[model samples]
Target: MEKWAFITGASGGIGSAISLMLAQKGYHLYLHYRKGHEEIEKIKVRCEQYGIHVVLIQADLTDLDELQNIGRTISRMPDVLVNNAGLTHYGLFTETRIEDVEQLYQINIRAPFLLAQMFTPSMVRRQFGRIINISSIWGMTGASCEVLYSMTKGALLSFTKALAKELAPSQVTVNAVVPGAIEGKLLQRQFSSEELGLITDEIPMGRLGKPEEVASLVWYLIQEDAAYITGQVISPNGGWYT
Candidate 1:
């Protein structure tokens, strides 16, 4: 039987990398993106070269209606679910608005929770599944200005642990991948050149991580050999965080 992997935020750097890797591995993809139509299209075209089915799913995870619609859009339940869509708030906690908090919770917490509810029952029945959450280093160690983002990601870490135990009896696995300072448009947009330089200097490895590096860890966690590795929080931060 063909495998299906559903990845949210499939247009972002890490998301696209995961999608491509899975496609090359022969899994049909359900690629979800809130926007970034052009970028997602490029990923779709590239993945199709692997001769696997690629379905584009667009949904604003903040909206319950749209989020629910994603379940209907996909043809089958995914054997692997990558909760990678995230929104970050980069301001002092005091300066954070209610709207920012809501969006953060919606995207980073609620959507993944609901997606789990929608998909995991099928996984449990099938007796195999991989749930990989793309979390952050800030989620592990709090960040000064990104209080809300950190909280939401920390929630995912907890979710991964709890759900792993819940699904382990059925041979399903849940894990969180915490990444640090990856080189991407999101990081570049949020930090200045000098700030990024300082950030890179703080890492013992002396460089920001590549998207493929993170994707490699994710690729491992979803494999049959990794079935024993559930409820673990693994970080590929280049020695930036323990």
Candidate 2:
């Protein structure tokens, strides 16, 4: 039997890692991206070398109508759905505008909820499925300057817990991955060299985690070995937040 997985933000760092890792596991991938066809094109080529099928799904996740279009292009219902698309705003709560807050929620929290509504029915009918949401440490412990991002991610964590219970009876499992100080553009863009050093030093591992490490966890959850695990907010934070 073949397994299909749909992943949003597939052109980006973490999403690409997850897509490639799943391809190596022999899962057909539907890689979703919001912008720039070129990035996913590279990833698609990489996945194909593993001899697995990879499809590209493009959607402006903030647009509800566009998000609905994602599943229509792909013929099969995915056995796995990874909601990895999100936006974050870092600043004083008072300095942030109302619109940015709304946008953050739309991408981080709303899109996942909408995608679940679209995909979960077939999953329940099939009696097997896996859903993994890429969450952050800020979601678990609120960040001082990133108040808006924290709120939406916190809601995602709550959403994972509640939905896991509802879907588990049908053999569908939902989980979230909480990552910390991941080596990515976001960290580079957000912090200075000295700041990054301070952050890395604080981590017990003394380094940033590779996106592949995060991808591996998502791979593990879909296996029969992890069937007993659901509704859990598992962190791959290198003991940073434990």
The numbered model that scores best in lDDT is 1
The lDDT values for all models are 0.95, 0.92
Measured on C-alpha atoms, candidate 2 has an lDDT of 0.92
Tell me the tens digit of each residue's lDDT in model 1 across 166-198.
999999999999999999999989989999999
In candidate 2 the C-alpha lDDT for residue 191 amounts to: 96
Residue 55 lDDT in candidate 1: 93
User: What is residue 26's positional error in candidate 2, in angstroms?
Assistant: 0.7
Worst 10 residues of 2 by lDDT: 65-74
Error of 2 at 86 (Å): 1.2
Give all candidate RMSDs, comma-separated: 0.7, 0.8
Candidate 2: count the clashes. Answer: 0
> Per-residue CA lDDT of candidate 2, range 25-74, in tens?
99999988878599899999999999999888878998878988776877
